[model samples]
Target: MDSSSSVKIVSKHFVKPKTIAEESKQPYYLSPWDYAMLSVHYIQKGILFHKPIHYSIDAFLEKLRESLAITLVHFYPLAGRLSTIKTEIPKSFSVFVDCNNSPGARFIYATSDLCVEDIVNPTHVPLIVHSFFDHHRAVNHDGHTMSLLSVQVTELVDGIFIGVSMNHALGDGTSFWNFFNSFSVIFQAQEINKNDDLCLKNPPVLKRYIPEGYGPLFSLPYSHPDEFIRSYESPILKERIFSFSSETIRNLKAKVNQVCGTTSISSFQSLTAVIWRCITRARRLPLEQETSCRLAADNRLRMHPPLHRDYFGNCISALRTAAKAGELLENDIGFAAMKLHQVIAEQTSEKVSQMIDQWLKSPFIYHIDRLFEPMSVMMGSSPRFNKYGCEFGMGKAVTLRSGYAHKFDGKVSAYPGREGGGSIDMEVCLVPEFMDALESDEEFMSLVSF
Candidate 1:
């Protein structure tokens, strides 16, 4: 089958570790952030490798399975299943994971006649590339499907695509990347006759401690993950991927600073401001309509004494900035960028700590419905994630994509361009009319490569 057809599964099985660490064979508690995500699995992500390997398909699958199993020995929570607390007591309603005898992650081997060139075609049909991933295993839930990690490796004409579907409740982007890097390290060690005793580059720390007063706050009922699933299925949506050159980004930063009469402005502030403006303009919201730019900020270092880089689970806070549609459209890019900068400035480590403290008093509920409402956009992922570093004995990935971008509307996923250095890629999903307007946007098109 080609890119347009369903991915045919050649083989599928679980990849359990040959032996589990004695310390890991116990229940792992979910942090407040993690428990908050147990109701949804919106954090699925994937990367594509375009390098050709000399090994046969069977050999490649075997190597990957073996390395992943070894990697799971260190990052074992992913091998387990989430167990909701079963009691009428308010405090007992929280969820935790039973790590003992976990069935392990799912690994699937598949193939397609689709060429790399066709998969990246600018004029390709919408959602055609999503066939490269097994979406149901990531977002859908059933009695039989409990694995937190699901991987599908498809052999393309010229290269291979490794798609990872991770449950948000299991961990955040940091944990996901940590597991991937550990897997790569093990795979590389096995590939070459290197020392097998190489310590885990970033060993996971899984002890979860809930701040005092966190339990009583989450007692309120909120929308279910199933409702999110229903609202996220937008057949009328269109997803577009664009690459911004490092030079263009630099130019944008300089332009914003010059216009704003300021000396300092981050690339994120400038670029995201530009895209936010374009998306707002494309939507053509009325002047009085309010718009919000919600950017996911990693809070790993936001608390005093900072969470370790290897601290597993969700440690993100969405910093939002709101403005009137007319003001956003009428003002120059610098104004919007300055507003973004102010938002970032307001989220200091103290502020984040305060937010966490307040969260224990009243847990935050993620409202997926807000994304579908008019004039709002949620931005996620980052250039700082460095997906290219996920080398599994193969060379760096030729490109990276989530593949399942059609699952939501008005969502933007950003990543560092594989071209190296400061280049960036913005994967945007919007309703068809707004996408059309964004495509026809002269200013936006001038700065971006389709």
Candidate 2:
């Protein structure tokens, strides 16, 4: 975790440990549907490596155990009724293949002598996860590509990294973040309590197999023309954190509003337009390419009888729109602002939100492919910043971000509470060339205003 330590601590080793569940005296035929009932989701496991100087790994682990116990109380099954819902992790999870089987889902599996307290300088905690995959993932495919889920802790001041790989079917960002924050409270020694009214009576039994009728509302005629092919082909994925003063962005917003009509636009939308122009120009793709961006809209309001912060499950929806990148760039910034606001407001509805959930329940399951596509660079706003405050009492988080998810051409994550007022820490991951170009170009850099 420290700069002083050698960076080569990630031992080139692959290990997977497995044990089958003890044969119960009684056997039960749980339906395959039952497995879907439980919290397929995991509490995200990230590390806080302390400098090991004068601090024993044993001591740190003990603190971890205490934290774990506190977190476990808040851990509950997802809102559903499936026999295996609360099923303990399966033997099939890591056995017969590759996965370190990281202990406690978060811990320091030391590869070297240097510990956290000794770390005068430390890298991001998530880097550790990357190092493992780069070095440890089995080249020989052994049926378990879902191997990254078993988060492990390894020590080697080489550099600390935090990793969080959740089950895809887990709660939506709203619910998942709620779980993350709840778990974080244990570190703060705070209590994690469910909403008093959140009684789990008559949970939804809708099978994920059948996508319900959100049709007509969700269905749009997609007749593609040859030249205007809406082909999204490319393995685009990477993210990097970029900072901007809130004052600058606010001024940009005001100027944009004055130029455009009274239509409200967010700072995220304005920035997205600027980046869209840059990317369109850089790729040398169609100047008038119908570049579409999807806003990741939260749908806590979409459910019947209404769900609140604690109602976990995919409660997020997307609102997508398109414009000629060339035209967007030519107009004042406010034009793009109106574009973003219009697209988002249109999407902000129970009709669309339910449509998404219903679509998930449909027999025609093509949406999995859609998740990887870049969706407005994913601006996650209003997540509690208490995770950053978690200090081993060593120091505060200098910088934090939602790291690169290797599935988009580029994506951005906005975390709350920057040093300046009303500014969110924005992490932008794009093609390496774009990063280079952004660094070099005055005009593009000015648009981002970092």
Candidate 3:
């Protein structure tokens, strides 16, 4: 069969909670951090199961649906929808989740002739992999209580691919992973015995109140979503995955240490520095132009009374550092690596508290649109997420992939390679012009296995 016609959607439906949760009627308030993600609707994650498994498609679907239903009971807020409310305290508009359980999470079952070997081992993943997902279910165009999570399971010739799209405002990457891991555990339990009353090992804490250290930041004035809600659109956008072996990473770290005359930096820091420097050079911006690297710093553990690892909300803050284009290009990788370390280190609990306190005092939420330009880069996701642990009775993921919407110029994502043992896969997006430069850059290509 031709690749385009190989995949077919068998069915689409919603997986409701097994039982109505007590908190189903309660409203879940959006935290200040959560509000920051209001402009972005959803995040898409995919995992490929390549190893042979014994279960049939029918059995696997039953396990996934049953487990997902139970998981939704614990993560009940995900079964809700987003709403704009008028608060009496400040007489202002606020964004809140109406846990009305109006519509359950969407689930799709699909079949494909595509082999896992063709998709999992490729350095440049084809964009068609996105077709396996019901991508439209994620965006709430009508702005009503709909599904906050959408999942698609595509059976391949050799394995299965599970694609998940979760509302960005509902939670961060940590929350998403927690839900997936919990769901996997339930699935595993079901696989062992047909009838099992499984409970989440780490049930989510869905309290709407922001912890005290986060300060008295209540609802701010709501603005027109169009201001910060613009989707990335470019005429010549392209995305490709670049693999870096453990040996390459070790060599890069050693080079960074040698340049800095110190061995304190981590592989993440070194690799990020190398990528940033190479990108800056590829852009070939003016010497005086400013270039910045933006990333998210998880603040769940940085707070005074640290939040539980299972805190089900956005417990992260944005971190940015900038240097002149000339300086970022001229400086060695270690210099950039040191700067990255310093910026991350500065996100201490005390510092985060002060930052939130300052934001609270402001009368309105500031909307800073990150323009996608050659001179700027924004990093998404991280290498530390437990991508390999999402085993749903079949086997651990052989490889991982992200959504196509991330294919905007200046956007990047990093994930653990399926090969494991400190390997990293970098998914990069750029305009054709800069992408050509990046591909031809000898130093960058030397480190990546293409």
Candidate 4:
């Protein structure tokens, strides 16, 4: 007999214990969301979909067991409280002993939204499950917990998807990427010390010293939350994807800059402008609609040793950009790229690093975050995740998608990985009609492969 490794092959989700520091970190309140990070070694969750990716009643749980030996961890009911105060990591992290004995993971089958999932959705915000599959993490940002990525087997037609729900209080995209990359290493018989350079060395950086007029923080005239939700109504969680040859994207970046008269814009900036343009027209808003949204810019470069490839765990900040929708598209792609570069630069550095720290340290943390929660959207990049290579040698993931529906109601995501060397895969979910129009457009299709 062999000892169970941190990684194992399984068909279900599992829960694990939080680390020493992880247990100690308390949830800090920020607006409607929290500021915190939990190293619940593995909150492995997955969905079982049938062939063709439809619901099926044939799925069952019986005598399903594996030697997971993972640390037992559960979500501490924030009861809606923040998750990054000064709580203990390993000890305060033990909310499982307090669990009402809820089974760790349950796989269900349902065809219609009305039939399958409605009955079994977790009634609580932080769901706790027990199992041995260590492949995912979920977090609650504001209105909903945002799941990063999903790991699942395909439904024969080469289609499979996983939905992760997580809280934004946890580290940032850098943090999530750290854990995910560690997961891959651990899964492949590699060593992973949380403090490893591949991960964060010290704890997460929480400094907040943002200048009053700093950042792309221009107040927009969007309607109230109630009014806003109704008009911008659609899926609260969205799954948008973009594809292109990795090489093609690099080339396009240069090409757009050449034509747009500025080298400030990169592939992401140019493509983002395209998405913004399409989105603006889709809503039939005035051509001058001042689109407001935020971007998660990596701050690894600002760290002393620089997070480098070593530092990890939420090492990023948010940047809110504002400009006329028409102007955004009306300008050369290069100009759009320049604005994006500037907006992104504002979010990085010790300034934002310290600002976030002070904000979290303040009593007005909750109040300040809530003020902006209703008026903004957050956009992230999947360009560097390299998810396609996660196949464990079976094969590249047939499809990699995010569980972000309305998280970015005005979300602008650009991930150009998939198709071998230079090809990119781009996706977006706006009004169904808007998506349909993009899908129907022959000119757009010429540039992108569905």
Q: What number of clashing residue pairs does each candidate have, in the order they appear?
A: 0, 30, 0, 82
What tens-digit string does per-residue lDDT give for candidate 3 at 333-396?
Answer: 7778888878988889898888767666653332234433456777878888888889997677
TM-score of 4: 0.58
Ranking by lDDT: 3, 1, 2, 4
Q: RMSD of each candidate?
A: 3.0, 9.9, 3.1, 11.6
The parts of candidate 3 lying over 4 Å away from their true place are: 1-3, 51-55, 87-91, 121-123, 137-145, 209-218, 223-235, 363-374
Q: Write the per-residue lDDT of candidate 2 for residues 1-450, one digit (tens) a residue.
A: 444443343322222212222221122212112112122222232444445356565555454445533443333222111111111233111111111222222222335445444332321132333432221322111112332223334455533433333332334455444444544444444223422223233232222222234221121122211211122333443345555667766776777667775637767676665655565555554556656665666655644434554544455555666677677667766666677778777654557545645434541222223543432333443333344544443344444433223224555555644464656555555566665665555555674434
Candidate 4 lDDT score at position 32: 11
- How high is the lDDT of residue 442 in model 4? 48
> What clash count does candidate 3 reach?
0
Candidate 2: lDDT of 303? 45
Return whichever of 2 and 3 wins on TM-score.
3
TM-scores, all candidates, are 0.91, 0.64, 0.89, 0.58
Q: Candidates 2 and 4: which is better by TM-score?
A: 2
Model 1 misplaced stretches (Cα beyond 4 Å): 1-4, 51-53, 89-92, 124-126, 135-144, 194-196, 212-232, 371-373
For lDDT, candidate 1 versus 3, the one ahead is 3
Q: Highest lDDT, which number? A: 3
Q: lDDT per prediction?
A: 0.73, 0.42, 0.75, 0.38
Model 1, 1-450: lDDT tens per residue? Answer: 343555578988887765677866666776667655544443556666775657577888888888888787777777877654434443324456667756788898888777666567655233555666654534322212567777788888887888887777767777777777777788888888644455786788776645665542233233333432332344567777888999898888899999999977888789899898999999989988999898888887766767887888888877889899999999999888998899887888888778777766676545455433556777788888758888886788877767563245578878888786788888888878898999899889999965
